[model samples]
Structures are given as structure tokens and as C-alpha cells.
Target: MRKIAYSLAMVLLLAACNSESTDKSTAEVQTKQEVVHMEEALLGKWRGMIEIPQSPLEIILNLKELSGSISVPAQGISDFAFESIKYNESDVAITINLGGSLIKIAGKLKNETIEGTFTQNGQSYTITLKAYTETPVTYEKLLIPVAGGELKAALEMPDKGTGELVIIHAGSGPTNKDGNTIGAGSNNSLKMIAENLAEKGIASIRFDKRGIGDNTALIKKEENLTFDLYVEDVKAIVDYAKKDDRFNEIHLLGHSEGALIMTVAAQQNDVASLISIAGIGRPADEVLMEQLSASLPPNLLVESEKALQQLKAGKKVETVSGQLQSLFRPSVQPYMISWLKYDPQHEISNVNVPIIILQGKKDIQVTEKDAENLYAANNHATVHYFDKMNHVLKDVEGDRDQNLASYYNPDLPLTNGLIEEITKFIKQ
Candidate 1:
């Protein structure tokens, strides 16, 4: 579904007080001395938590002499640099620009902790930080070489090895290896899946796609991207796993758009099994039209349909309305054209390996009909539907608002029976 635009206009608006250019040389020297003293006292690693209701997110700030970076493990963000850091005698203000949204942290240094207010999009939350130390590594960070550049990935190995490895692929639209996207905050769905799988003695690998997160160097231009390129990337990952001696079996698991990608890749690569979670069964254009029809105005919906038609026919629409540009942008049209040609059912039907389809009834983005269509195309595939699960693989018992809110909550565990079913399917 076309929700928020993935491409962000990252404009860092620094609120630091600038010294007047006309200041005397003596004033400049004094300012420089003040800054050096501030850096000496504040430059170090600090750990804290943003007290988000029901989900307190842990954050780590590493301040160097001149620059600083923040890491949110729950969000799978590591060492993301701060746009600006301003400090005085007892107070510090750090600003980070994310997808055009400004996250400003204002903190006062207390006796042993930095007490702060974290504000983002008009919402403020209390935060506190103390000095931090390095911890033991639980997972291994990896970089798999592809054609253009290396793909950033993490490999999680269980304490007890099962000799089985599952390659996890994230969904569409700037989603990182952790299943979190820009502007959507973090749910850690894919990251949770990998951790849970590891607990069951399964190894897993999750990677950032070509142009997302750490792999941004892989894409020279967005217009050059294609659906087939994603499939090829999966095959490349599979090849990497095949060469490693740690695993006896390799399985591919894809969520949302990744489901369709893995489906096509499974046919070309030598994988043991395939898993699809909340994957679309129809052509992507049909699904896009259905999703937009509900949210867009009648005029915009008509234009969206026309654009989809052109893309489906292997043609590009040069003209797109301002409102629809995020979805049908000129640079992204080639990718849409490549994606629109694949029918999930048709792609799944071509897979020779064992297949399992996971669907959730409460999923607002994908319907049960999509799963049924995939099953109809390949009756041999095992299908499981969870009554309470939503699209992010989280359980929801309330109305639409609660279901949508789960998208931003990383503390929520995976829906009951989700990991169990996947584990069972893989062991079989």
C-alpha cells in the first residue's frame, strides 16, 4: 500500500545559535575555547530511553570531539549522525532530521544523568541518559558483495545450532533489515522474527536492500531499479549462504512485497523452501488501485488508475498530479512498471520447492482473498491464517486504530503461532 513517501527530503534545520560574523577576533577565540571545554566534558557514550507510553525505546548517543551519532537498537538504526548539537554550561540540545521530521532533544546535565525532553512532531516524552560502556555482541554484522556494492546485513546465530539458516527479506518502500521504514517509526517485526527464529536453534540473515539504509551506495539512480534486480539480489544472498559451511539447509522467507520477490527468486535459486507472509496474490497495480481508491479523492484515484494502466502496459506516464507524484513519480515509474508485470499467483506457481503462505485476517493492507488466490494457484502450498494478527505480524484485538498503532510499537511481540508455524514448516 502507498502510505508515506519513502524518498525523504532530508533537510537538516540546525537551531544552533550562530556567532555574528562581525564579532571581534578576541570574541572568536573565546567562543572557540568555550566550545572545546564543552566537548571535553560531554564527548562520550551516553545511554538513555525515550519514555514512549507502553514502549520505552532505548537510545545510545556517542558524542565525539566535533560530531555525534545516535543508535536505536530497537529500531535497527546504528550510529546515525546528529544534524546539530548545541550545548551551554549545564544544558545540551541535539537535533536529528529524519524524513523531514525534526527530532529535538533538550537535556540538562544532572549529577550523574542527563535529564531530557525528547520532542518529535509536537509530541514530547521524558528521557534520561547516563554514561555507557560496550556490551557483548550477540549477532554478527555482515556485508555481502553484490554487483554495485556490498549489502549490509546481520546474521543471528542461536546458542544451539540447528544447521538451518533462513534468509529474511523485508517488504517494500525503504524498509530496512529490521522491517522499519522512514516516517513509520519502528516496529522491529523482521528483527523480532529473526531473533525468535534464533531462539529455536535457527540461524537467520536479514539485509538492507540496494538503496535503503546502509546499502544506499548500491543504487546510482532510482530510475535504474527494477523488480528483477531485487530478485537477483536474493539469489546472490542465497549463493553466499550456499558457500558457507555453517548451514545444512537454506530457506527463504519474505514479508509483504518481499514475498513476491522471494517467490520469483526461489524458482531461479537452489533453496530448500519458501515462506510468504502477507504477500499479494494479484498484480501489484490492482492492489495499488484498490488501496488508493479508499484514501484518495475521486480525481486522484482516476489519475492513479490511468498511471497504473500505462505502467502495466510497459509504458510510462510523463504527467502525474502533485498529489500522486509520490506514488507515480517519474523516477520510480520504471520500478513500478517492472513490479506491475508480476502476478504473485503466477510467480508462486512456478516455484518447485515447498511453500508456505502466512496471512492475517486483521491485516488492513492485505486481505485474506490474496492468500486464497495464492493457494488456488498452487494447492500444494501450506496456508495458515491467524484471526487476530495484523499486517506487521502483531496481535490486535481492538478496532482499526489499535491495529494501525501496532505499526509503530516495537515492544509488541509477534502474533501467537506465527513463529511456531514457520518453525514447524521449516523443520518439516
Candidate 2:
């Protein structure tokens, strides 16, 4: 019964990603296995924990017949409503619309417990449930203006007049204000940073990227998304901080892809400083090739190079190989074309504000070399290297696989140097 429910859930997930998925038959066949008793089993409050790496994050869900909400109360995320609840055979399944991304949980009931996996963005989390405990902390739900909608953000303000704010820019994809998205394990990197910054009397605002979280419904077609949209989104937040008298200095702190976006955004805003955390220092295309060249099939790699050249030339390729579609799909080419135009090195060189470049020797994604390149362009920038940190700012020491595994480890605390460095820089 467990196997059957899991299989059906996989089909549903695939269908959601690409409606024309080959699993059309599997999706069609997955129906109500039994509705009566299963629904009753899912009622009331449920509590579970996802154990990833050294961190264990707790989850709580409250469900009625057709509705309920799921939240990670530990991280101050409470009552994110669930849109779909269904009983598939003797097994049960529930779907939650996280902004626009859908997360599905499927499992079989055993001895008054529903044991299953939470699947999103091709990442699977083992969720063992029984029921909720403890009231959660109060986190301010802020609405910052954007193109089509006000990008919702989690704002943690300092008690007194630090008179400074750091806009925390999440990496990429559907990453929410908390620095988590589908497929990637929920590490809560950005959320942790904001909370930590508050302790140091520094306020921070972290928002969901457009087409994600509160802004998920903004873009109907993926093909219509552009890199400029994100740049504008960051600018909007800066404008908000400028108007609010709570802060006099507005600084930008971006991680991974957000780091590069901040470089471009800094040019348009009167920010006090820019902090690039694990930001790439090369052209987008070059960084992309380095990441994919080793993993892609020979034939697919050849085809990808051709498509990349067209994109770099400010043209989009009509078609890409099926295997390569995940990266170079027609729907995403427009944004890719817009993104490839920026050289992180060049952008950093042009920044009018003081810059701090950080790198982790253990990060498998953007290496130490990238940080060195950024320093080369901006010789006046302050550079810090952490030998213990990984890409997500987690304290991980070891080979690539072991370090990468920390993504799922909810118990692991972020590295030590980040807060100390940022606090000193901002307060100074």
C-alpha cells in the first residue's frame, strides 16, 4: 500500500512539472483508492520532523475535510494553507500550494500514524507524523512592492535605532523568503541569517523572488520572465527602506545567484555597501558550463554549447535536446539570454559602494577562484575566506558529496564567521 501511494504521488508531481509528462497513464490510473476512513485519519493536528544532515526541522499540519495548513513553526512559518487534500485508496495524500510551487505528501496509515515522504523540486523528505505542540513566535509578514504584486517578505526588525537595514537576497529559483525552494532541501539559510542579524541590532528584509511565494502568480508563462524583473524587485525593496525612517543606511547582502543580482542592483540604488556571499565572479555562461560540463552526456553537452552561443549572442534557440531542456528549455531561454549579458567581475568593478567579497573553500558550486576573480576586478574590496563553510553558509568540512549532503541536514548551524564579519562591517 505504501509503495502504491508513493508511486501515484510521483506521477502527480511529474504531471505538475510538465503536464505532457509520459506518466499520463499513471496519473489517470491513480484515483480514490478509498475515501471514507482515510479522510478521517488525516483530520486534526499532525506533527513531524524532517531530519537532514545535522539539523532536524519540525513540521506541523492542521487539516479539516478539504482544507488545512502546514508550517515549520520552528522557523516561525505558521499556517501556510493547504489547497488540496485527498485519500488515495487506503493510503492518504495531501497537497499544499507553497506560493506557486506544489508540495505533495503521500503515505500509508499505520497504527494511528501516517508515515510518508514530502516531495518537492525532485527532493524527498521523510516525514513521520503523529500530532502539533507549542505556540510559535510572532514573525512580521511584510508586503514590499513589486511589478505585479507586492513581494511578501519576512522582516525581523531590531528593537532600537540601529538605523541600518540589510536586504537579504536569496539565491535563485523558487526559493522563498526563507532561502528554501522545491527540489533543494530546506536549509533555512536566509531565515537564519535574518534572525541572527537582528541579534546584532541589524534589521534585514528577505523576500520571495518574483514567480515565487507571494509573487508566484505574477508570471503566467515561464517564457515571459526576464532577469531585469528580479533586478527591479531588489530595487523596490531598496526604495522601501529609503522611505522608512527606521534605517539610514541600506546595504545589500546577497547569496549565490542573488549576489550577482545585487551587483547589478547596486548600480541603480544608493546603497551604503554590497556584500557578495558566495557570488560567482565570471560570466553566467562560463559558470554554467563549469557546473554542467562534467555531468552532461557527450551528445547533450555538444548541443548545449551551441544553444549557449546563440543565447550569448542575444538570440534564443528554438529547441533543445530533451535531456538538456531542464537547463536550456525554450521557456527559460529569454531569462537566460538576459542573464548571460552580465559579467559578475565587470559588475563588481563598477560598484560605487564599498564591497565585501566572501567565499568558502568547501563550496562545491561557486569556488574560491570566483572570489579571487571578484577581488581582482575590485582591488579595494575586502575579502574573507572561510575554510569550513559550504555554499549554503553551513559549516561543512569534507569532500563534495559529504558537504553537499548538509543541504538536507536541518540540525546543522550556519558557519561562525558570517555573522561576526557582517555585523562588524555594518555597525562600523
- For every candidate in turn, the CA RMSD to the true structure comes to 7.7, 8.0
Colliding pairs, model 1: none
- Most lDDT-accurate candidate: 1
Once fitted onto the true fold, the runs of candidate 1 whose alpha carbons sit more than 4 angstroms away are 1-86, 89-137
lDDT of 2 by residue, 1-428 (tens): 13333333333333333433322221233322335555466667887765442234467777655556675632334565555567654476777655346678887768878788887656677878775454364456788877876777777887764888999888877667777754345787888888888888888888777665555555656678998888998898898878988889999999998999999999999999999999998898888777778898878777888888899999989876656656776778899999999889999999988889989888988989899999999865899999898988898867778887888675678898789998888876
lDDT of 1 by residue, 209-301 (tens): 886665755665678899999998888888988888999899999999999999999999988999999999999988988989889999999
Off by over 4 Å in 2: 1-61, 65-107, 111-137
Kindly give the stretch of ten consecutive residues in candidate 1 with the minimal lDDT sum: 10-19
What TM-score do all the candidates reach, one by one? Answer: 0.78, 0.77
lDDT of each: 0.80, 0.75
